[model samples]
Target: MTAPIPRDIPDLPAIPGIPVLLPSHVPATAVVPPVRRPLVATYRLLVALIAAAAVSLELALGSPLRTLSHFAIQSNILLAVVLTLSARRAWTARRPLPSALTGATLLYVIVTGLTYHALLANEASPYMLPGVLTGEAAGPTGWHVITTQVLHTATPIAALLDWLLLTAPGQLHLRPAATWMLYPLTYLAFTLVRGELLVPGTPARYLYPFLDVARHGYRSILANALLIGLTSYALAILLVALDHARPNPLRHRLHHRAKTGFRLQPPVG
Candidate 1:
């Protein structure tokens, strides 16, 4: 004979035409709260304001806030912000932090487009490096030079890596090394092609100002590249970590209060 069923275990309950087992006990689990919508909206608005300031800066300075291309990019970022906010209101009813912040990063890139332009602009200066390494100076040399410089330089690769970092499939894993290496790899290709290191008339390395800190007056280009590489990787990782950071003390207190209020609200009995 089968052993008697335990007292704690409920037997199958038979209805006229159906059989079902009912559990006697169910344990609840702690649920992780979703990132709140208002938090994302708050951040999105801040990014929007920053973008607006960039526009204002461009107008005041009577120059495109980076590249003229950046103006269109800024417009796209604004569009993304509006689209994201609208979609959240209509569908999720809460803005997602990741999506909103990705848009913010795009906005940031647009704002800094001019800075990159300034660095890469072509001019007839004795200081700027020539041909393969420097690309073109950012002065009045027109789009032909600017476009040529961009094609020759590592900016495209760097931008592609930035795009990848922003839109990686799942949870945002910060790959700082990958991001940092793109520029160096591209520049290295250009440098090798020009034989800038071995050639007698190696121009100044200021074509990549960021790389100059390690250049040591054109003596140790690779060493400088490595240094810049390390610094770039470090900063990228730090920024990504900081981006994913949860609430700090003050924010934690506010969040705690909010969660407490949510929990204390009466549920329909």
Candidate 2:
């Protein structure tokens, strides 16, 4: 018998019309009964706890009336909403999240983590380093630290870890990235309208310095917004690419018997 072909070396032969770039997971159309596993249960619970803590801290921002005005708080609220909703199915019935929801949430958190650090973090503070690393917040009080870091740092990291380690992949497509713009676009419209209505002399009329048209000039700010939107779409493309990079099928079979493993089996070239 040919010594069981070593899975470490892929043996795909290049044949005409044969698929080389096959999906790495079950097809999205596969019919299966809803199910729950202990491991999936654990992951869902962890995500729920993290999201809840972040939002609770947000609510404790000392001024219940004014807390939602800031975009950072709004985005984190959105993040909490998405994370909670995604976990519901698992929490109630022990099922994994749908691929599309998974991909969209992943992209949103990654974008959230990236945008805050790059464009908004306090460049002067060393603690701003977390924001920098997340590729990432500052709060005056202990609550601020928890909420801000959890929203900008911990939440994003948790969401990413949910995708990169605990979840299976191969459910995303290019078109959904286009759909992901709805939340951001709607939020932008709201921000602009609210900023315009603020008292005439308000210097920082806009929540973000970059979006403050009175200070930056409409032409300049619009250009910056357009550039950021383009960059966001580009990031969406990368998110789609990552979804396709499921753990290698060969490696899956090779290590099928492993228990409670957390290794990211690199895909074969």
Where does candidate 1 stray beyond 4 Å? 1-44, 63-66, 69-95, 99-172, 175-227, 240-269
Report, for every candidate in turn, its global Cα lDDT versus the true structure: 0.39, 0.61
lDDT of 2 by residue, 1-269 (tens): 68787669877777899767866685432323333334544665676577666666666744443456654566556656665655565545444555666676677777777776776675753224332211113234555656666777777787777666655566578987798888777767877888888886763456666676787788987887888788888888887887688663333433443443333332211
Least accurate 10 contiguous residues by lDDT in model 2: 130-139
TM-score result, candidate 2: 0.69
Candidate 1 residues 32-97, lDDT tens each? 223334443444444444444434443444334232223223443444455355335423333234
Predicted structure with the largest lDDT when compared to the true one: 2
